[model samples]
Target chain A: MKIQVLFGTESGNAEIAAEDLAESIRNDNQEVEVHDLSSFSIAELQHDSLYVFLCSTYGEGELPNTALPFYADLSVVRPDLSGVRYAMFGLGDTFYKDTYGQGATKLDDKLTELGAQRTGEIGRYDASSWEPVGEGAVVWFAGVLEGVSATR
Target chain B: MDAPLSIAVIGSGPSGCYIAQSLRKALPQSEITIYDRLASPFGLVRYGVAADHQSTKSIQAQFSRLFERENVRFAGNIEVGRDISLAQLRSTHHIVVLAAGLSADRAMEVPGEGLPEVYRAGRLTRLFNAHPLEPTGVPTFGKSVAIIGGGNVSIDVLRLLIKQPEDFANSDIDDAMLAEYGQAPVSRVDLICRSTIANAPSDPVMLAELGRIRGVRFSCSDPIEVAEDAPRTALARAKAIGELLEVDPGPETRAEVVLHFGWAPVSINGDGHVRDVELRSVNDDRTNQRLGADSVVTAIGFDFDGGDWHGLGALKADSETGVLDQGLYRTGWIKRGSRGTIAENRSCAKTVADEIIADLDSLEQQSKPGYAGLPEEVRALAVDYAAWKRVDCAEKEAASEARTRRKFPSHEQMVAIAHNKLVESSAAQRGN
Candidate 1:
């Protein structure tokens, strides 16, 4: 089974993390495809069983510049996700309080609303942390592998 | 192994934060506090770097870690000389590192420069970047602009004026200002200089970066060219100054960036507002010319104002190893004069840090109470890191869907939101 990794980033932080995660997934001997959300099409949802969103929230809870097109198309057309299992890892700074990691939650909700299965919980990483950067994303990915393997 | 030492770093910008981070690494137990006049960190980075340069602004993420440390603290809305005197900080902390970067613009001293339309590049930069210190909103620069001095900053301002609103969609530039700039009838930019292109303070790389921007034709009064077989750096600069570099702008092009080299502005003349920039050639004949310009901007260097404010006088200290004067030190632009970029401050700061560590044993120790020593009234007025975060949330939350940030340009407005949150939090606490 092929796994797809998509990322939307403002300051290139989430994109770097997505690359790392993609490399890690490839090391697991499973075929994986990675793309930036700006270039990714909503129609590609039918091609894969496993879909992963690595996105960062920008300016309150708004989507990154690259991810807006994906969100806009998904919202207007309301793509059918009847058989897909998806997971999300969002990068955000809790300094913004109420608006932190709205990207992950919004994506998670939209996918579930369209009849897609949630393979794992929405993982949100606090940008304010110093020790072991983006450790939350790694911990969240651990939960995802179990679901992906069980489906395989 | 010893009692925690107190250290105060003035200016919560890149230099100040770097000092805190360096000191923390050297002395993990040291209590570090950063002070700023504004209710925000990343001083100039917030109010300096071009809006289009998101990658450069990303340096703040690295500085953000210093605030989260148990030993490090942010004390906002405090001026060292006014709120608490320089003497007070010296008595409170064992070490006080003054990293308050240059705040004043050097006067051009040219005739008619005193006109209202003629302004400093630093002032314009702050106004555009939404500096809290700059109470004034964006000033109007009319259809034609004449920029004096040739440097990266001159290129930066030119880039800003020529860019379309769509280019700023992903940037933290003021969305309202973007809308205002969209309607600006700006069609020409004249870069006035008193010397040859080689004498210009800006780098070849910066000129190359300016070249990459789309939709702008280039020309010069002189036949701009570099010698054959010039180095890569020289070749890039020659090409930047010589070529009419642009990307597929149809018809007559949107705007033109014309270089007026070897021409010194003799006067910035107008009736009550800017009308033209009068110039004299650097040649022996001293030819005179006047270009019709609605606005004139001086991009000449910055001025250091620390010593004049405090009783310190000139603010110069030996930056070789360290100043090594009564636990006082200086770094960044203030130390070496405002010349190098952000990365240059790191090495200079590290050298000072080494000196600080070397003298730690011999230096007299004091049981100082950093920000905690501030009177309740002063504390109330100061915006702490948490309160700033609330203001940050409010600013971001207020932005339009397509915009990156809705900045709190007015210092008064930011202070209101920051302090109001504190009042509500305290009121709720009393009820509880």
Candidate 2:
């Protein structure tokens, strides 16, 4: 399946993580494309067969600078995502108790509200830990592949 | 097989740590040495960030994790230009990354700057954070503190000065500084912005925080009025005066601090000691005001100290080439103008690093002895990567024991620790 990995990163951490995951996915014999959220558009996202969203929550649980406008449009415009299957990984520090991963959670909730199916549970990565649990990404990809195979 | 490439990074600040981390993961075999001017790492996080912002300071934990890698070494108290020269770095390592951040603050250049009470926000923040400069002594917060500027730094100072002990306890403020702040009889603080409230550079979070101050009242409408003997007032002064007028002081009570906006200091009235500040209205609008305060702090911003790098010739370069000098790179406030939040620097650094890496493969195609002209000073030093790691461990242990973040007290301490480690290693080598 063609997989699109889009990332919104502050300090380029989530972007690096997305690139690593994309490399892993491609190594598994699946086609993968990675794009920075700043350069990627909502309209372009419609073409992806499997969507993976990796984003970091910035100040006060706000979206990263590059993803702010896209997130704003996604929420108010209510774009249809009927054919989309996606999963989100939120990068944040647990120290911020009040607005923990609010950026990614909002996007995930919005996509689901727009009728998109969440392939698996959202992955929450505490940047304070500084380790990516690839198990979550692997399982989500497997689920997406299984769905595609069943449909075929 | 060829030997793995070795890289030396000067200044173990955020950019340096990030560069080392990226290099370690991308090129695992490559050896990395992170050299800092101080014994401790995490430059701005340890020095510049306000003590009250513990949530932001916690990001250093991630950096500490990156340094834990076997291939990475931390060299504390190694001043690049002084202890090690550019020529020496080129000879010892295949590549050298300069991630040293800006060290000095920009000046307001107004007439009253030389006044006894005049201070810079950068220095003030550093002093309160228990940075090496903190030992000098905390600044006395007079009856009224007028902070000039509406940026995050100004807001940070305001919050630190005005917030009570309970608010500060939840954060990681240094104990001594906290006590000093508590005893300071400063009651009124005036934040002066050049423009209207809407045009202020303060972030929404800071604005909200300012609004939440229980004992402090904010005035956006009132401006300061200039007395005949007072200095000229800027537009901000007009707004402050309007706000101050609205405030009702109880009988036998006065606002402890008055934040004067709009009036830029034209001259100092007193002889060597600052008696009063002469003010001028901004834009020559004729509306003037004078703040009759004993102390003043110019919170304009920071500028890069380019004097040291002047020998590098055209230190400036196109976005594609990193720095004009080969093997040299600039990032963060040093690369671009001082603007944007901390996260913006990541992209800036990445862009420069990518440019250097792109040229790397091509340069290696026509390879020669990389370090042909070694500087005499760098060649004489017996310091190595392993010795640096020992000093790093010692600093981290000390910080952990103190239940605080890592800190290098002085330049001398850092070098002494590193030198001792080098001697110990030599002794062990002979024994073995």
Q: Output the TM-score of candidate 1.
A: 0.70
Docking tier of model 1: it is: incorrect
DockQ of each: 0.02, 0.30
- Please, what are the lDDT tens digits per residue for candidate 2 over residues B387-412? 55566677557653223444454444
lDDT by candidate, in order shown: 0.74, 0.64
Residues A1-152 of candidate 1: C-alpha lDDT, one tens digit per residue: 67788898765567656766777777777688889898998998863567888888764376876788998898999988888877888887664555688887888788889889887677777765523334555667978887667867
Q: Candidate 1: DockQ?
A: 0.02
| Candidate 1 chain B least-lDDT 10 residues | B423-432
Candidate 2 chain B weakest lDDT stretch, 10 residues: B364-373
Taking all chains together, each candidate's TM-score versus the true structure is 0.70, 0.74
Which regions of candidate 1 are displaced past 4 Å?
Answer: A1-152, B181-183, B203-205, B209-215, B227-232, B242-248, B280-288, B316-324, B419-432
**Residue A61 CA error for candidate 2 (Å)?**
5.5
